[model samples]
Target chain A: MGEFHFYTKLDQTLLLGVKAGNAEELLAGIQIVPDSSIYHHTHRYLHQHHYLSPEPPNDFAYWTAHVLGDVVLGERLWSVDIVGFQSIAELRQTFVNILEGHLASTRRRIDCAGGQEFHFMASRTYVLPTPHVAHNLAEFAHILNKVSINSLYFHVFDAKLRLERGENDFSRWFRSLGKTELAEKSSRLDPYSHTLDGLRREIIAMVEKHGSD
Target chain B: MARIEDYASFVGQATIDELFLLARHLEGKSVQNVNSTAVGGGVAEILSRMIPLLKQLGVEARWDCIKGDEKFFATTKKFHNGLHGVAVDVGDDEYEHFLEVNRRNAGEMTFGDIVFVHDPQPVALIENRAEIGRRWLWRCHIDFSRPDPKIWKFLDQFVARYDAAVFSAPAFAQKLSVPQVLIAPSIDPLSDKNKELSEEAIASVFERFGIDRSRPIVTQISRFDYLKDPLGVIQAYKLAKQRLDMQLVLAGGGATDDPEGPAIMEQVKEQASKDADIFVLFLPPASDIEINALQRGSTVILQKSLKEGFGLTVAEALWKAKPTIAGAVGGIPLQIAHKYSGILTHSIEGTAQWIKQLISSPAYASKLGENGREHVRNNFLITRHIKDYLLLFISLFHEGDIVYL
Candidate 1:
């Protein structure tokens, strides 16, 4: 009811991860802003990008505000594709790279110890551009299951997307060992004007609708 | 009339002044708290009281909760039981459900300068520290001295992410690599529930509840959860009733997240139905004054919890200078100083024995009540808690900033 205070800087731990390369740059940028100033700037930024409009209808404004302020939405920023890797070797290498860059050597060692125990199956498919990321995620999960690591995982896609798509056809298919629709769409659209251009149009339209709603 | 300063005599003005000074020192510091529910539990109650006081003191303190669905709550209830050394079925779906809720809550709430995530229910909110800059502190109110390995490992990941962790008792602390602090929970002596009641006020409350002033009353006011052991309280009262002319009052309400509460309450009602003297009260959330009246009107108070997270109600009864017998678990030890302040027992038999002794011996009960009020004044009052939090907020900013002023 009072004035909504937007945090100026990105969260410190999130910033630390970004500095280490565990997270993205754009996200880490918000760590330094004042709390109230963040909302003002982000609202303006989203408006310019057509993610929102200044004078959208009440419903559009409400949902737009909700999405912007929601911490759940921001969680997808550094989302690694758990199912994207081809092999345990690939997963190991990517983790090694992350540890060498984004985390301390000691932390990386811990991550590796935990990573080795993880086993992602084609069974735990999630809604993303690829299915393999889910498999890759299984590595960390396996480690978590085996080891005594008391860590918190957001599982952003697992929590929000899985529920939205429903437990039927799409979710069941995603949980299977097959490929996902988004990845296929992107691949098909990669070479053609229809897929990329059509996606662009959709994003623009969604942003417009969100802005003015 | 019941402003914060009204508690000065009990908590000491010098102590209150020092807390204000500490809060002022941390005026620019940002702090946050994360817990399960914002309304039903003790953490929420304390935060609701503490946050406003923090703002009044000029330090910015925020509160947040970890989001969970019905399935997530069910899993976490198992996690809670397991943390207290109860074995339950916790498979992959349970773990996934738990993570799903944390992810949802983490996405919805805002982070502060320093984050204080309370209990296991919302521990996952710390995962965002990789993106947020404020210092994060994990506050554990539950006893985890002998937690189940399966559940503890799942929680350890998030606990390790924070800068520091706080526990209520020494026994409850685990072997964490991070720095840990010990700060016991406290009650507001100036609050309506804890303030002294007049003869007329006490009498009116007893009359309204249909409690005869002639008969000695024994009451236990807490949530209708098994951990609080309301049915066990009834059993203890029944045992004590065989020797003395007394009435038993089991007054408690339900929490939103605790789905098993209604079933537990039904069981308690069934147990209490054998005797007419057993008064089973299902009080609403806004029944704080009624609770105050019940505690005040009672000859003795009981908090026979099997597991507890600092029974503030015990402290509330003790603050009113009522002789109380409580189970020695969680934060109960901090409030009761054995025979000095109040009595602490483990089993229903021990609770019954203490109740019988206190009810039969009026002089001893009065002596214990006198000692208990001073105990609350010296340690468990809200002013002391405010000081502890203010100092915590100040510690986040400076490594060597100390002032005699």
Candidate 2:
């Protein structure tokens, strides 16, 4: 089964909140991180693989309405003014409740008995790399601070998407910014030869080594 | 230096005086033209004539050619076809190669007061304009009304960065963010290709090509490109020959950058070999006097193009007072006023019909030829072309500045 990769900052923040069992820390993580940096990679990955969620997101309401394909649910989600929540825990709970409500209301089943019984098949589950490899919170913090590497990884990721679709706009624009080596490497990248998880692991290792230096 | 007054006899003193007035406005500004080729194509032909004339009018003008290898040119040739609405497979690799070549050329290029980049070959040079700091103008000499969506989208980015864009016809203009100027291409009346030739010289050309002077001759002069529809011209000639006894001359040569010419020439030769009435003469470059003789010797001229930039041959033929029948595509319609100056045809059958009618009715053919010559004299001459360019250069400094002439 193919694995899905998360942005290092997002992964680090989620790991910290889960370990500490603190929803407030998770909310702090979401707020502190620039939304575009996280969202741009997700949107590009989904769009490139032709796995886009119906109406692709341009903003919060559109993203919810189109991606989730539920206008009323999207309106309810939009009603929670992201900035108005007094605590990160409250914001976290609101998101969790809306998702749980959507799952409960939209559940479906099929009966397949006509004298003969058939076995139901389960689809392969997506996996994410464990974030515990970093020894401590300090190591995790150091990794997250390497935002320049995140930006580099974004170029590498975006370039692969463009190459797969036989487009060079991103790479050309990348070169125009005086990033010739990065642009050249991006054009030469073969997406099939390297998986997203594999690239993420390599970037994490590089960031950890750089922190040691 | 050929002065502006040299064209007075052909275009009149009033036009010459007007051009001089406009040239005075462009006094010290230097104009640099960038294109892909130095020979063979209309862009090179026009620049060769225009630059010297621009100098004579006291407007400093220079020309440069962008360097590219075979693969780069092969890719750009596809771009040329794609821009003309022809389906071509231009993927990421092609785009990469195109940009790589442009990047190399961009490193060597230095701009002037007015940098005129021609066609798609050197269009990407505008990417360096921020550092160079010059007013850049992109002159599109091809029909770009409908272009490949992907290619057009990519080119549009560079085009948007330019100060202004120039097109040969109003129909060729796209909805560009920058201002667009419509200036039709012109033929040099004093050049070897359009200069007056003696009957002896015309007869010698016929003898050289072994063309039978006894039979009425119909000719189409253009490069052997599929867009020119040379095979379709042969079909039209065959159809016309069914009703009347006549000879056909398909005379043209290839440009260096156009790799499709030899293959298209082979296809044209194979099509023409079916009959002896047709003469497929592949003239060498700079055979202007020979081209002039061929146009003058023709009873009727045909330019049956599927798509054209400006079809300068139509203007060249009309200037010779030949009853020209050109395809009703691209900038051909701008020159031919349909049943007035010359005829415009849409298909092989239509071209055949016009050729047959013009051959049979000498009086009507002669009248059309007379009207066509006058039209070219008043509009499509080099004198007017120089005036238009001078005014364009002057207008760049003064936006919303209208010149009353």
Candidate 3:
């Protein structure tokens, strides 16, 4: 596993994504570099953890891995920047390339605002690496069968993928990702992510384990 | 002194005197208004004018918002659909989301001596009755004669607990165990929308927008929500334009709680693009004076909402004596008395028919405007609204085991 690092974005330049416990304090203490822009924005203030800023003259995987890598693997970070590309097709291409070999994983933590919080985790984050993602839903299901579904967060950073976030309930589909391998294999075949036969069987087993409704 | 009077003169002396008379009875009582958003919608717009007027009248009235996130607002948006009789397949989680936001608001907001909770957004705040001994009223601003059962069941639990539930129209009221009052929402005749604009102000607005005063302008001012039906307004205008060479201005903005507005605006644009006579405006929330000038500059005003709580814009345009043709829904019927005051139409075809009638027959349109202004003055002015509220608040103080309508 590669060791994680952080970097901050000042204007167009990536400084370092710092891993300080208090993002507010880290932002206040950091001084602006001379001849550099005095970057002042709420997004910069709110975003504390930065994993890696891909060097320029990079491909889609660099931007995709740079953006999704931290959000998928990292905990305690509010946002992950994919860094913009000339077109979304290029970004999708990068996501496909990264999901080819490595199965990424991250431990779970609670995300809270005000006084309310909930636990979430992403065990595996990957891309389909195939064409016609939506129309060919069966092929995508085949890929889901191979990967361990125990991950909390899974994202395919495409406009088509963005629509599914609304179509599928985040909390319910997220829990379905934590199923056993046999159940996960079966769930991949189910049309709906939340209501697959395999996902149901896994949920039944989970409720039994936790002794819940 | 002239400037002070100029601003103050908007609400005429007669209206101010009437407010003072009503204010003396309920001088020290703490009145709290609870609603969805402090910006955008008509309820909030009325409160913005009314709260300050109430304070000036020596009443301690304050406004509070029900806390909600994007997900919760989505649920409330569903509730709005259901309340207005739209068929929506809202799930159990959506109901839970509504309650969750209400709980947050109930925990945060201070319940006053007279808590006037407005609309379905904060209706569930009445659940905090054990902590509050004062009057709690649920003010329903939408037409709810045929609300979806799924939403009504969830809202009924909260509304049944209220001391009283006030609806805009008699038809809007449900058969509840508690007393029901019909207090229609009013427009501030002195607000920016109805205030007298100088010729210079009107000309400047026209010049900035490249609108020529030489041609007659047909305008519809509303938020770009589906219920307002901006696309229908454009279609009606095109139908009316075949006879008269007039320009159409569809000017509106969106509300924070209404996420579907931008898409609706896009649809309106797609439809408006077919005709060069049509101008679709995506105005910001603070363009009140701009709206005033638009209304003043126009020859005919239309508010063709498919479903409305009470179309304050109709009263606003009517108060300015601009002949309006509004849809006959919600509280619009109360404002538009057919041929006497303003014209009310049921369909887009009917709206087009009336628009042509008003445009060609200037004498008839002038007479309608003359009557419309008097109708607003007699029934729908803010003075009348403030008086009704004072009386309603006073009625809440009476001790009775159960008060009957």
Best model per TM-score = 2
Tens digit per residue, CA lDDT, model 2, B1-405? 455677888965644655555576677889999999999877898898889888877888999999999999999888888997878888798899899999998898777889999999999988877788888889898887678988899999999999878778645656678776767788888888998899999999999999998889999998888878888898888888899999999998863345676788888788778878789888887798999999999999999988777778999999999999998776776677667678877778989999999999999999889878977876689876876687667667763211222
Interface Cα root-mean-square deviation for all models: 26.4, 32.6, 31.7
lDDT of 1 by residue, A29-114 (tens): 33432222222222212211121112122111221122223222223222333334323334334433542344232332111111
- Candidate 3, residue A109: how far the Cα is off, in Å: 68
Q: Which tens-of-lDDT digit does each residue in B11-63 have in candidate 1?
A: 44544554554555665667777777889767788888888877776777777
Recovery fraction of native interface contacts for candidate 1: 0.00
Writing each residue's lDDT as its tens digit, candidate 3 over B125-207 gives 87878776778988888777688987898889888898887777645656577766657778765667777899999999978
How are the candidates ranked when ordered by lDDT, highest leading? 2, 3, 1
* Superposed Cα deviation of residue B119, candidate 2 (Å): 2.0
**lDDT for each residue of candidate 2 in A8-61, tens digit (9 for 90 to 100):** 111110001111012222223334433322333233322221211121222233
Candidate 2 docking: what grade?
incorrect
Kindly report which residue stretches of model 2 are placed more than 4 angstroms away from their true locations once superposed: A1-213, B1-3, B67-75, B89-109, B224-226, B254-275
**TM-score, every prediction:** 0.58, 0.60, 0.58
Off by over 4 Å in 1: A1-213, B1-3, B35-37, B64-78, B86-111, B128-131, B223-235, B254-271, B347-349, B397-405
